[model samples]
Target: MIAIGFEGSANKIGVGIIKHTPDGKVEVLANVRHTYITPPGQGFLPRDTAVHHRAHVIPLTKQALEKASLKPSDVDCICFTKGPGMGAPLVSVAIAARTLSLLWGKPLVAVNHCIGHIEMGRMITGAKNPVVLYVSGGNTQVIAYAEHRYRIFGETIDIAVGNCLDRFARILNLPNDPSPGYNIEQGAKRGKKFFELPYAVKGMDVSFSGILSYIETLSTTHLKTGKCTAEDLCFSLQETVFAMLVEITERAMAHIGSSEVLIVGGVGCNERLQDMMGKMVAQRGGYLFATDERFCIDNGLMIAQAGILMFKTGHVTPLEDTWCTQRYRTDEVLVTWR
Candidate 1:
């Protein structure tokens, strides 16, 4: 069976085609992505991101098909991210998926964004039942599979880690060419000093708003007196926040008795974050599993992967139920395939 997935939950619009063989092997036929980057010190608005996705969805789908050397008739299902993202962008992609499902007479599967990330990570790394640290611009969670569901062990009570980094990048007027977090990572490599920042971790949940607020004040001070460089702030922010993340992940691992750790989502692409996680997992006598940019960041492959699993289990979203939401929790969906 072949599945084409659409992902436009945020600034990136991606289309991917995947084939599942009779022997239960999965092949990624094609994965094409385009990002909508805003100017320096500016963030992408929902309306503009939706417009970008609407304009590129068709062409990207065609490109994916062409790259996969397949026709529309070869596809068995249409899968799309349905929630836990910007509502406008999610709806734009869902509308496109609905149109394709209707035109091709294929089944439609609405996938939760966070579940997509976890499933894709598992597929890529082959980590069976590992503790998952899902961190992105919009989400941060420590999850484990229990009782036929991916249960959340810890999450952000305030802003996400990536959001804190992106806002701090705006404070420094960093270029958004690839991403704010990527720029921050690059700048942090050049840093030579470390500045103290607030570290807030309450039980299993973490908070970044206070850290962001403290960093912003430090940035203001730097702008006034030039006491600290942008690189230092980026380095300090990454170190502090990443430490909090590693702490929570370690706590979850200890509690769940799982030594294996799987990192997913856009922020999971950061080398520093991965290194931190690697160290923590190593101390527990386990390994860390992470994917490259293709699967780490938002993409259609993950959506297709999760969607195909659902479709095979007799799951399909009706037209009336194809609406997108901005707060779809990961644990809300039942993992029938597992």
Candidate 2:
């Protein structure tokens, strides 16, 4: 069976086609993504981001289909990221998916954004029942499979880790060509000093709002006094925050008694973060699983891969129930496929 997935939950618009065989093999026929990059020192607005998705969805869908060497009629299902994202962007992509479903007479599947990341990670890495650390601009959670559902072990109490990094990048007027986080990572590579920053990790949950606030103040002070370079700030921020993430991940791994760790979501692509996590898992004599930017970052393939699993289990979203939301929790979805 072939599935076409659409993803525009945030600033990225992606289209992917996947083919699943009866023997339980999955092939990524095509996975195309285009990001809506804003100017330096600026963040994306929902309205404008929605417009970007609306304008690019058709072209991206066409490219994906072409790359897959399949037509819309050949697709068995249309899958899309339905919630836990920017409302406008989600709706824009949903409209496209709904239209395609109607136009091609295919089934529609509404996928949770977070679950898509997890499922894709599992599929790509073949990490069966491992502790998952999902981090993105809007979300940060440590999850594990239990009782036929992906349960949250821990999450952010305030702003997400990726949001903190992006906001800090804005303060530094970093280029958003690839991504704010990517630029921050590059700057961090040049850093030599380690500045003391607040590290907030309370039990299983973590908080980044206080850390972000403190970092912003430090950035302003540095601008006036030149006491610290931007590279050092980036380095310190990454070290402090990623260490907190690794600490919580280790705690979760210990609690679950599972040595395997899988990191998903956009922030999962950071090399430094991965290095930190790898060391932590290695110290425990465990293994760490991670995917490259194509699968780690927001993409239609993950959505398609996850949606196909739901479709195979006889799940379908009716047109009337296709309204998009911005707060769909990961643990809310029932794991029928598992």
Candidate 3:
């Protein structure tokens, strides 16, 4: 099966064409990314980013098709992120997918933005029934697979992990132009020892809002008194948050009795977080798997990869199913795709 995927869930607009061979292997023929920058601590503004997507999405889609050397008719299906994203961006991306699917007479598959992350991890690592930790701009969750579906075990009671990191970058006066995770990773790399930042871990859940507030307060205090180092603060902040995640993940692993752990979502790309997870999972004799930016952040290959499998199993969406939403819970979705 061959298909095209469109992802405009956030700042980076992506399109990918992939082929699934007879032997049950996946190959991405073309994957392209076009980025849009927002003000500090913001991945997107509904008004501006929607207009930005309108200008580039059509051409980007065409380029993906051309680069893959495949036409719409050649694609077996058209897939896209249907919900759990900005309303304007979701509508823009969904509109393009719907139009293409209609014109080409291809099946359309609507995907949940967060589940795309876990699916990417499964696709990349070939790990079935593993514990899933999905962390990104909008979500931070510990997930488990049950009865042909993945369900949330524990998640952020407040702001997302990626949002926390991005906000931290804003307080530090660092560049938020690229990914917030990348900026924090870069800032932490230049530091030595960790600074003394607040660390909050509560049972199976964690809170970064207090830490975010604490860091901002410290930043202001340092500015006024000139008594603190920037590098140390970044290092401390990264350590605190990563530790919080690691602790909860380890606890969840034990609670769920799963030995394999895979980290999904864009925040999984962070070097320190990966290191922490890798170490924790390894210490407990478990596996820790993560994705590179290609699949880690929002992209089309994951949608295409998941769509092919789902569509093959008759889990496709009809034309009447083309509606969009701001919230799509992961647990309620039972995988009709085997």
Candidate 3 lDDT over residue span 1-338, tens digit each: 89788888777778888898999888879888787876674546877777877788889888988898887778998989887878898888888889888888988999887777777679888886778888988888888887877777788888888888888777766766666679778878887766677767777787888888988888788757867677767888888888888888888789879898888888988878999999998999988888788778888877777777777888789989888888887886777764
What TM-score number comes out for model 2?
0.99
What would you estimate as the lDDT of candidate 1?
A: 0.94
Error of 3 at 218 (Å): 0.5
Query: By the lDDT metric, which is better: model 2 or model 3?
Result: 2
Candidate 3, residue 58: lDDT: 87
RMSD of each: 0.7, 0.7, 1.6
lDDT of 1 at 148: 77
Give every collision pair in model 3.
none
lDDT of each candidate versus the true structure: 0.94, 0.95, 0.82
Q: In lDDT terms, how accurate is model 3?
A: 0.82
RMSD of 1: 0.7
Tell me the lDDT of model 1 at 141.
Answer: 97
